[model samples]
Target: MSSYTKLRVAIEKPFGKDLSSAIELADSILGNLNSKEVFLIDHYLHKPGVSQIVEFCRSNPLLYSSAGLIDHIEIISSESIDVRGRTDYYDQYGVIRDMIQNHLTEILTLLTLDLSNLTSPSNRPFDLNAAKFDILKSIYPPFLQSAVFGQYSGYQDDLESDKGGNAHVNISTTPTLAIVVLHLQSPVWFNIPVIMVSGKKLGKRETIAKVVFKKTRHVSLRKKNGYCDDIVFTIQDSNGSSFITLPSNHNFNLPNDKTWTYNEGDGTSCSSMKTIPLGRMALKETYASVLRSLIRGESDLFVPLSNVLESWRIWSSLLLEYEEGKGEHLMIYNKSFLDNLRLTLNGSTLTVFVNSSDPQDNLVSFEKDGISFKSGNKTVEKIKEKIFGHFLYKFSRSSLAREISQDILDTAITSVQARDSFHLALPGGSSPADVYQSLVVDYKHSFPWTHTSIWQTDERCVPITSRDSNLFQLSKTLLAQVGVPYVNIHPLFPVCHKSESVLNEYASINYFDYVLLGVGKDGHTASLFPDSVNSSFSPFDNNETVKFVKLPLDYPIKVKERVTLSMERLVKARRIGMIITGKDKCHLAHVIESKDKHNSSLPFVQLLRKAKPGTVKIWMDRNICKK
Candidate 1:
C-alpha cells in the first residue's frame, strides 16, 4: 500500500434503502483496498437508523479512532441528478457517477469510523469468467501487468463437502459482486489507474474515473501568451489497440479508423506564429497611413470648406439674381483672386491684397492716402456688435445678406434638425438685436420658429431691463416677437447670478447648430478682447457650451462682466458666419484671410482657425476688404 497524506473519497450514492445493496457491494471491494476514507452522496439523507450509525462514530472518539480501519467516513446529499421518469434512470445515474468521479461535494465531516463493525455478508457469488473478460476489455493493454484479482470464502464453505450437498452446509465466495483493481506498472501509467468496475446488475454504472494528460507544443508567434494546442484520447480496452486518436488537424477530414500519425520522422513541424503589433507601433502605422494619403492629395482634409464654399457661391449668385430688382443692397466678394491668395500648413495666416475695384478696397487698404480708419474704444464695441448682428440678420434676410448667410444657416439648421435640437450664442448689442429682429421677420414663416431655443452669447451682469443685458434685448427684439414658446428660450435668469454658473449650464448642452459672431475693429468678437485681460478661452474643456468673460478697459467703459461662448464652442458649430460691413473692419478682415498663428491674436483669426471646414462664411460689403 502507498502512503497518501490526505485521502479524498467521493461517493456516487449515499447508503440508503435504494442503494443499500450497491453500497454493500462497493464497501466490500473498497475494504480489500484498505482505503482510509469512505464518502457517500445521494439526493436524500440517510434514514434514522443510518443516521444513528453515523452519530455513534462521532460521539465516541476513542472507540472509533484513526488507528482503526477506514478512519474517516462522510455522507452528503447531491442534487445534481435530474430524473424525469423511468427512462431517465440511466442518465441520472450517469450524472451521479460523474459527480463522484469529478469530486463535486462539500466535506460534511472527518470522523474516525471502523468498517469492521459493519456486517459483511458471509458469501458473495461472482462469475469469474465474466469478470475476467470485463476487466480485460476495460483497461489498456499496455498496463495489463498491473491488473489483479482475488477470491475469499466463509467458514461454512470450508466445512462443506465437495460434489455432494451435506446437511447445514454453506458455500461462500468473495463479498463483492465484481472487483477490478489495476496497479499501473509502466512509468507512464504510474499513479494513473486505480480501480474500475461497471455492471448493470450492480445497480447502474455510478463512477467514471478519467485520466487526463496535458501535452504542450511550443510554437513561435507574436503574442503575450503562447498558443495552446489540445489533443484527446479515448480508451476502450487493454493493450491500447482498442483506443482511438482524435483528429488534430482542423482542415483534414477524419479517417474512419480514427488513427493519427505523428510526423516526428518526417521533419515536419508547426509554423512559427506572428504577434500582433500594439502600443505606439499600431498607432504610428494608422496615423502614417492616413497622413500619407493626405500628403499624396488622395484625401481632402477640408471636407466642409469645399461643400460650403460651393454651396454659398451657387446660392449667393442665385439669391443675388433673384433680389436684383428688390433694392440696392450690399455685395461682398472674396476680393483676392486665386493667383494672389496663398495656402499654408497653418490655415490661420494668409494675406490677400484686393484691387481698387474690390468693394472693401478703400475700407481696409494700407495706402497712406486711403480712408485712414481708426478703431476707438466705442468703435470697437460697435464693430463687434455689428459684425455678429449682421451675420445673424443675413441668415434671416432674403437679400444678398440672406444669400450669404443661408449657406451657413442651412448647414447648421439641417445639422440641428438631424440631431433634434438647436442652439445659438447671441451677444447683447444693437447689431445682434437687429439680427434677431430680422430673424423673427424673415424666417418665422419658413422654419419651426416655435421650436427654436435661444440663449445669450454673452451678458452683462445687470438686470434684463438694463441696456447692457443681452437677454433683455433679445427678448424684446426676437423672442417676444417671434412668439417662440417661452419654454424654448433659456435666458440667464435674475441677470445678476454669477456668469460662471450660467456658462457652465450652457456648456452642459449638446452641440450648437449656429453661433452668430461679430468682429471688433480692434479684432475682438463677443466679449473676447484681443490683448486684454480676461481674454483666456479654453478649447480643451469637454463641455459643449460657451464660456463667460469680463473685459479689461477704461473705467465706466470697461466691460466689468460679460458672457461669451468659448472658441471651442464656436468652432464646433455646424455653421459659423461672420458679418463685417464698415470700412473700419477691412484690416481685421485682411488678417482673417492671412495664414499666421501670430495673427490669431485677432478674434476673427481664432474663429477661422477653429471653424469647421467650409462652414465659416465671411459676409462683408466691398468696404471691409479694400486693403
Candidate 2:
C-alpha cells in the first residue's frame, strides 16, 4: 500500500440515515482520506443506458431542445414482486431508502446537469462531477404536499407470512411505493416537475427515465391526434443502452435518421410512425462497470459529498412527516387509486382520489404540490360540519362524565373481545378527573378490569408519590377504587427498567384501543406544549412514540420536565376521546376548529388531521358548542 502513488476508495449506497448523520459521516471520511477522491457507488449511475443520457441529450437537437423546454421529468424504477422473503431488511429500509435516495436521485442529477458548464464535450470524471455538484446546489427540497406514498394491498399479510406470524411486523407502516415530486430553484428548470417513482409489487418490472415536453403551437395541425413528443430512456428491453423517441408530427423537426419514418393522415393526425432507436453501447454489468471505474480512479460515476447532503435536505421534511405518520395518504395498489393517479399525473391535471370503499370518503382532490380534501358531493365546510357534528357530544356536567365513562367501557369490552387485552391511555387534568370518578363509581365492577391495561398519557418529572404527579392523581381517583392488577398499570415515570425497555414495550403493544385526553387552554392535548423544547423533541420529527420533554424555565407550567406519548402514537389509537370543559377551553376549541393563524402550531389540530376520520370522540359541555 505504501508503494501506491495515489488511492481512491468507493463507498456503497445509503451513506447515512439523514441529513445530520450524512454530514457527520462525510466529515469523518474526508478527514481521514488525506485529500484522496472518494467514489460513492450507485449502480444505476454506471448502467450503460443511464450513463448515456447526458450524451444522447446533448447530441440530438430534438432531445436537447426538449431538455430546455422540459415540462416534467419522470424517473421510474419499479418491481413486479413484493419483498421476496426480505422481510427484516425491506421493512426497515423501504422504497425511499433503497431506491429514490440514491439511484433515482443520481439519475436526476445526470439528466438535469448543466451541460454548458463542462469545458469540453469529453466525458471526463472531474468535469462531470463538478457540473453535477452545481445542479445539486440549486435544487430545493421536495414539497411535502406534492408527494404521494402507497403500500400494495395485502402487504401486511405478506409480511406476517414471511416472519412466520410475527404480529408486530404485521402492523408495520413502511411504504413499499412512493411518488415524490421535486423542483429546481435554478432558472433552467424552475418549478418543473421532477417526479421519481419506485415501488415493489407493481404492474411490471421495468426501469425508464422519461422527458415530457410542453405542447408547441407548431404542431397545431396535429390536433385530435393525441400525440405527444416524449423521449424515453430505458435499459429494460435491450442488451445495451437505447432510447425511444415517440414519433409526432414534428419528427421532421428532428435531425435526419434512417430509423425514423413519418406519414400524414388528412393533415389532421399522425396515422403511421416509426420509433427512432438511438445507438447502443455494449458494456459490462452495472456493478462490474462501476468497480472497474473505481479501480481506474475514475470519479465521474461517483456521487460527491455535497450532492449527498443536499439530497438529504430535499427529503428531510418528508421523512419527518412519515415519522409522525402524518404525511400523504398511503393508498393501496392495484386499486383504482394508482390507476387514476397514473392517468391524472399523465394528463393535463393532477387530481387524484384515495382508495376507499365509500365513494364519499375516497375524495382527495388537489393539483401538483399538495393534497386538499374535497367532499364527493358536499363542500369542505359541509364535510367539516358533519365531522364535528357526529363526533362532538355536548352534555351537562354530570351527563358528559357518564357518557364518557360508557364510551370507555364499550371500547374496553370490544378490545378485550378481539385481542384479549384492552390497552387504554389516560391523561391527567381537572376535566377528566370527574370522568375517571364516574368510571370507578359506575362501571368498575362490569369493566374489563382484568384484561385492561392503563397507561399514562403523560406524567410530571416529580416523584410518583408527589401530588403533582399524574400517577398520584390516578391512584387516588381510579387505581385504588378498581380491582385492576398492578402489573397492568404502565407509568411513564419511576420505571424500574431502562427507558429503552419501556419504548420496546410500547412498540410491541403497537396502539391503544382507546385514549382519553383533555385539551389545555394552549391547545395541547397531552404534555406536548405549543412551543416544544427543540427540533430533537419536535412532535413532527421525533420517531420515538414516547419522549422525555424538558420545557423551558419560562414556560407557564408547574412541572418543567415531563414524559409523554407523542402525537404519532395518539393518532394510532382505535378511538381518541377528548374532554373540553371550561369557558377558556371553549374559546380554544373554536380557534382550533376555525383553522386560524395558530392552527399550524396547535397539537390539537394536528391530531384531528392525523387521526382516522371516525375515531375521535369529543366529549364537551353544552357551552363549548354554543357558538
Candidate 3:
C-alpha cells in the first residue's frame, strides 16, 4: 500500500461507486509496481485463521512428518452470489476464473506445500515463480483424472450486459459451476488426489479442505437416518485441540455407541497439538499475517506464475474437450456442493453442517414444466396437475427445507394478519424430518406460535411415546424447541386403532391452513397406497373420510398399518407441501402418471388427480429429477 496511487473524488450514490470511500481504500493498494514489496495478495490471505494455520505448518515440520498429511485432499466452497454485486465481473470469468482459479487454488497450495523448503522473503530464491511448478506437474497417466461444470437453471435470466450484466444468454451451456480432481505425483502427495469444487448461486457459503489418508483400517457403524459418523485427526505444535461434537442416534438410546471412535498408533492422542479456536477471528488473523510478510518485502506467500500458467494451460485444454463433448470424465454436479453429506476426518471432508439460517429467497424460476388443470375442489375433477406441477428442484435438502420454512412462516403470518388461528397438518416419516429439524433451528423463533395450532395429517395406531409415532418426531423436532403452547397441539390416533373416530373428529373442521406431506418409495402419501380403493369399503358409504385398509402381513415397511388423512381432505388444504428426496424414489416420480386422470396404480397419482392448481407443490432434489 506504500507506493500505490489513491484516486480522490466524490460522486453521486450507487452509479458513482468508483468515487466512494471504500473504493479509495481498495485503490490505495494498487499501482505499487515500483514498491520493494516482493509479494501481493488479495484480502483472503489476510484472514487471521489462515495465517495462524499456515504459520504453524511452517514452524513445526516434525508433527507433520510423524502424523503425516492426508494422501487425498479435497476443497469445496460455494455461495449463492447475488446479481447486484459482481454481476458484470462474473459473466465472462464465471465461477471458475473468478473463484476456483484464484481463491480455491491458493487454499489448496497453502494446505499442501512443503513449508520446510520455503523461507522468509529476504532469503527466498529469485526463482520463486517455480515454487509450485513441481506440484502442478502431470503424473504418468495424467494428473487431472476428471472434471465437471454446470450452470444453474436461471443464471442468465437477469443478465442484460449493457447495464453492467454479463453477455449471458443461454444458461444451460455456460459453466457457472466447476469441480476438478488432480492426481499429484509429488513426494508429499504421491498418488494423492486433490479435488476442488466451487460454484455460484449455490445453496450457501462454505469453504474447507479435507485430507484423506488412504487405506486406514478402522471400524464404523453406519449412522442412522443416512447421516455419517465422522472423525478428525489433528497435528499441532504441542498445544491442545478440541474435536467437534458428533451426532448421536436420536431414536434409539445407547451408551456404548460413540460415533467418532478412532485409534492412534502407540496410544498417543493428538489432542495436545497447539491450535486456535475455529471461527472468524482466527481466519482474520491468518490473513493479517500474510499481509505482514508482504509489507516486510517477502514473496513467501505469493503464487508463482509458473504454477498459475500450468493451471490455465491444463484447464483450457479441458474446456476445449468439454466444448467438443469429449470430456465425459467430467462429472456434472447433481447435488449442492455446499452440502457436507459425508462422514470422515481426513482430507476429503467439507464443513459437515448446513447453515439453517441462510435466507431462502433464491427461488428464481426455471423452464416451465406446468400441469394445466381446471381449478376447483370437486372430488374427481379428475385432477393431479403434471409436467412441472409447481415443483421446485434443488440440490440441497437443507436448502429445500429452508425455502419451505419460509412458506410455512408466510402462511402463519397471513393467518396472524387476518386475525385467524393458523391450523397446520403435519406428516410422518423421515423425508420431512430434515425440514422439521431445520424449522426448529432456524425458523421456529420467527413464527407466530401463539396464533398457530398443530395437527397431524396421519399417525401410527400406538402411544405417542412410541418411536413409530409421528407425534414423537414432531414433539422432538419442533414442540420441544418452540413455545407453541401445549393446548394448540392436536394428536390423532394416540390411544388405539380407531381411524374412523379421528376422521369424524376432523370432519368438523372447515379446512387446514397449511399441510406438510411426504411421499414413500411406493409413491404413497399419508396412508394412501397403490390399489387402495376398496369396492366394499368406500369412505363415502361409511360417512367417514378416513379408512384403515388392512396391509399384507409381508409389507416392506415394518409397521403393520399406517393411519392417514384421506387424499380428498389432503387436497382441500390451502397449501399442500410434499418433499421428495433421494434417488430411489425418483423412479417412482417418473412412474407417476403426470397426465390428467390417466389413473396410475400409485396413490400419489390418485391424490394428484384431485389436487387443484396452485394448491399443491412437490419439491425434489436434482438427483430425484435425474433419470
Candidate 4:
C-alpha cells in the first residue's frame, strides 16, 4: 500500500545475523554493475499515525512528557485480517520478528523519547537517536523472558501447506501473536512497565497508543452544575461527523490540509485548537518517508543496527518461554480494553467508561476524561477525601493472588529445574496464608511440586503440635495438599533455636530460590518487631543467615520462642514477593519502603535494600494501599 513502486528487488537467503552474505550473493549472481542505490524499510517511521504520534510525542510538552514523567505506555495493534501470502516467510519470522520487534519497538522509543532538556527542536532531531539508545540501554534491551507468544488456528494450517496447496509438511510453531512488557531503567523512568501487544485475525483491526496519567496528585475540575469538567480534541470531516466512517477511509493517504477540521469536546479546561489524529495517508507517507531516507542514507527514519540486534536478542529469549508455556496464556487484559479503568477496592468498585463500552454493563459511574458526566449528582466531592500512599496500588485480591502465585510457580519451576533442589522460604501471616492456600487449592496443578523444597522464613519455636507453629499452619493448608515430599519441608524447630544444627542446615541452602514474605502494621516482618528488645539483637547487624532470639516471657504473642531468617538470607533469593494488605498499612508501607533510620528495625526494609533492582515485587491489596 505505498504510492512508490520498487524498480528492483534482491533477497537471496534467510534473513538473520549476517546481511552481508545476501549482499555478497547478489554481487556474484549478477556481477553488480556498480549499483546506484539501496534502501531498507523499517516502515513504522513512515505511517502517518505513527509519524504524528512520534512528532507530537517528541514536540509537545503538555500532551506527553519530555521529563520522562510517563508512568507507563501501552501499545496494542490487533487486526481482523490475516496474512495473504506464502506461509514459509510468514512462519519463519512470525509476528514478533515481522512486526513487533521492528515497527512496534520504534513506536515505543518515539512514545518515551526524552527530549525535555533539549532547548531547541533543532538539536533533538540528532539527539533523538542517542536518547532512544540510552533509553534502551537503560532497560538493557527488552528481555524475551518478559513476553508471551501465540498463533491463531489457520496459522498452523497454512504453515503445513505450500503456496499451490499441493504439498504438506509438519506444522511449524511460529507465533502470530506476541504480548510483551518492557521496562525503562533511566533515572527519570525507572521500573516503568511499557506493555506492547500485537496479533492477527483478531476481533478488530486498529492501531492504538494510550498514555496513562501518573498516580501523582492531579487536579480535577468540578463543574458549576455539580459535575466534573474535562477537555479533549476531536477530529471531524467536511460534514462534521466522525472522521473515519467507511472502509475507503483507509486509503486516504494524502497530506492533511485545510480540509481537515478539529474541535473541542466535553469539559474545556484548555482552549480548542486544531489537531488531526494520525490518518491512513499520513501513516502510508510515514513509511514512504523512510524510502526517501534510505536513498539519502538517513538513519533518522529507521532503527540502527545496534538497536535491531538488541531487539533480536530480546526476541530470542522470548522464544524459549513461548515454546514451553505458550498455552499458559495469562490473558492479563485480553478481554479488558486499555482505556477503561475498572478498579475493585474493598468491595467497592469504581468504573469509568472513559473510552470503551464493553466494560460498564453494570457500573455505577460513567464518563470520558475530557467530557462531563451526564449528571452532576455524582460529583468528585461526594466521596470522602483521603490520601492513599503516593505509591502504586492493586485493589483486587484475586488478581494479587493470581499474579503472586504464578510468579512463585514460575520461579520454582525455573529454579528447581536448573538445580537439583530449589528452596522457597515462606512467611506466616494472613495475606501470605491466603496466597499459599490459593496456590495449594486452586493453582495446585500449576506448581512444580516434585523438585521443590519449602523453608519457613520465621517459625514460632513451639512444638509442631502447637497451633502457634508456622509449619503447622502451612502443613494444614498448602503442604497437606501438594505432592512435594515430607523430606523437602525444612522447618526451624524450637529445639534448633540457639543450636548450631539450625545454622548448618540453613547454611546448606546457599540461597532461597524464592521468598514469600509479608509486611506488618508496625513495620515488623519475620518476628522482628519494631521497638522490641530483640530488634537490637537482629541478624541484620552481622548479616547472619539464621538467628535465634528469645523475647521476654511476657512478649506480645502467646509464644515467646522465635527462630527467623535474616535479611542476608532473604536478599540472596532469586526473587521475592512481599504481600501487604489493608489500606491502613499504605502509609506504613510507604515508611517501610524508605528504609530510613526509624524503619531500620524492620526486616522487610533491610531485605529490599540488599536485593537486586528487579528481584523484589510487592503485591499489596489496593483496598488497603488506596485512600
TM-score of 4: 0.45
TM-score of 3: 0.40
Encode model 1's per-residue lDDT on 174-228: one tens digit a residue.
1111122222112222222232322222212122112222231111111122121
Off by over 4 Å in 1: 1-400, 404-409, 493-496, 499-504, 532-548, 553-558, 595-598, 625-627
RMSD of each predicted structure: 38.2, 19.4, 24.0, 17.2
> Looking at candidate 3, what is the lDDT of residue 401?
67
- The lDDT for every candidate, in the order shown, is 0.36, 0.67, 0.52, 0.54
| Highest-scoring model, TM-score | 2
**Model 1: how far is 390 from its true place, Å?**
18
- Give the number of the best model, judged by lDDT: 2
Per-model TM values vs. the true structure: 0.35, 0.54, 0.40, 0.45
| Candidate 2 residue 77 C-alpha distance from true site, Å | 2.3
Poorly placed runs, candidate 3 (over 4 Å): 1-395, 494-504, 532-543, 592-597, 625-627
Candidates 1 and 2: which is better by lDDT?
A: 2
Candidate 2 regions exceeding 4 Å error are: 1-5, 61-69, 120-126, 168-170, 216-228, 237-241, 246-284, 326-328, 335-340, 343-349, 353-364, 367-627
